[model samples]
Target: MNIIQQKKDERTRVVYIHIPFCTNKCFYCDFNSYVLKDQPVMDYLRALDREMEMTVQAQPPGSISSIFVGGGTPTVLKPDEMQFFLNSVRKHFPDWDENIEFSMEANPGTTDLEKLSVMREGGVNRVSFGVQAFQNELLSGIGRIHNTDDVYRSLENARAAGFQNMSIDLMFGLPNQTVDMLSESVTKALELGLPHYSIYSLKVEENTLFHTMYQKNQLPLPDEEDELNMYLLLMNRMSEAGYRQYEISNFSKPGYESRHNMAYWLNEDYYGLGAGAHGYIGRQRHVNVKGVNPYIEAVNQGLPRLNTLDIPREEAMEDFLMVGLRVLDGISRARFEQQFGASMDQTFAAPLEKLVHAGLLDTTDEGYKLSSKGILFGNDVFGEFIGSLTGN
Candidate 1:
């Protein structure tokens, strides 16, 4: 069925806007993004505006609980461009929940006071800075143009612009990064006293410079043991600092958890707009056209959807288990029955029993959750559920 002609579901409460332009690409990064130089920025924004108009008219969202503008570097947009883009959003998603969490991803060097002021006035309440590491050498080593000073300056500017609910992304296990270096970075991050922090281990995905370097034995990533140690050390540090490990890689002060991301972890439907974005609605998941010009041209006629697939009930059940287990609280048994119309235990007794016997999973009153030992070996636990239902 044509995606546009398909019946619209009003369950979507989260909106994700993807800005595909970046100042430069990082070596270890593989997200869908383009360098900003000589690109048709305004045309892309117009395309996005058209997509928003067509989308809400088709499906009209439920009261939007959260709006996340992520990307190549959302803050890289000029102030006027930001205004136009934000105005387009306000036009379509006029009614929002009282406590809407509007967040935008920014790079340290790209956000200045004026651009931040534009964001603030446009109703962006949260700012997430991509401050990958605090060390200048490591920053350069990872192909980041921003330095330590830019991180400090960006935070100061964000605060001056009246953003309190802010988060900074930190990465560990980089090339030539040491435990002490990571410790220092964590100390500096904690000292900021921000509401949220996301520290992720580096993954060398295909098509990235890091992957090519890895293939050539040129990337100097930490060994498996050191990487594991790094993860353990950060988990302990964040706990000691009074931050809750709400998800495996996310820590937050009480009540400051990222609601938009939580919607994702809970496997809820959301609107994904802009080039190369993915969306889930009803039972179908869709990916938008990837290339900039192609996406813009496609949306000019209709939706820019490149492909759509209806997720089978078993696959959705597997996805629910895999994604929900990322949260510390785990999935709820009642919610699973409500969503899939089957008992969780009845659906996959074999995998659940195996995981429980291996001490990788434990039962809660609400449902089953990952055990303390299971947290470190999460992929193994999630793997147990995949293909277990269909025996494929």
Candidate 2:
């Protein structure tokens, strides 16, 4: 089916609302976020509401199946302000799926009982906390605002506020992180008995403190072998604790997988609102203006704040391969064939053949998935699809 036909007949509708305010930026973060302490917060909220209206008006779909409010730290907004923001969303979108997954990203220090309760009342049911490590010194070393106490308190507050569905983010392969420390973090996380967890390896991106430190030879990151060991340890521990590795960085108990994230992995179309947020719909992609003011002004003037491009069919097929391979289930050859009316072998002949020969990618009963080695060097395999026209 064509992009427009695919979207018009899509089984699920999702929305991603970006909240770009943070009290301070984390040293390792390169996401589109800002520490605009004195910026007009209320005005930004109003602009966000207007943006939501515009998007819905342009592409009204059926009831949304998932809604995610990701950050700069969505919990930074005060309780009343959060209510207003969420209320605007509900007013614009008539209904959400009964099992709608509404998730919000929160930092430990910025959330409290009252704030979480406001979010709960506003229809946010899932909380993902950015708890990088268990050690206070390491937390500070990474420029995290909250201490260990705040982590526990945030979980307590979430539970108290009736948020039973929750997830905690932990990082491995940090500047001085040890396997034992990773074990401790996992132990503590399990003790809380959360339904989901996202454990990611540290990646130093451009314009971040971590990148600067690396350039200066000041970063004391663990050796490659150690980082690999950390990954193995986390995988074993999580599996032993009964959490399934649904995606590369995500683990969850049965029935707790993140619907919003699954939408992306499945290559479904969704609307993304706010500065620097990205949207993919009707087989076209767009990224909003990165700065706060530019986005707000563009929204007010009825102009597209976005740089838009129609996704090439070959490119879309390649993206389907790249992202879908990240899931444990791998990409479905049948679905790919159905979507593009092209054979996978004819499309990704070179990369797939090279990878299969190297034993880094193996064809499975379901489709093609990463071999153990492929998982280690997934970036290289993904790179092969980046500019391939046949695969798109």
Residues forming the 10-long window of minimal summed lDDT in candidate 1: 2-11
Model 2 C-alpha lDDT per residue in residues 152-234, reported as the tens digit of each score: 99999999999999999999999889989999999998998999999999999999999999999999999999998999899
Please name the candidate that would achieve the greatest lDDT relative to the true structure.
1
Error of 2 at 294 (Å): 1.6
Give Cα-based local distance difference scores for all models.
0.93, 0.88
Give the distance in Å from residue 282's predicted Cα in candidate 1 to where it truly belongs.
Answer: 0.6
> What is the model-wide C-alpha lDDT for candidate 1?
0.93
TM-score of each: 0.97, 0.95
TM match of model 1 to true structure: 0.97
lDDT of 2 at 375: 76
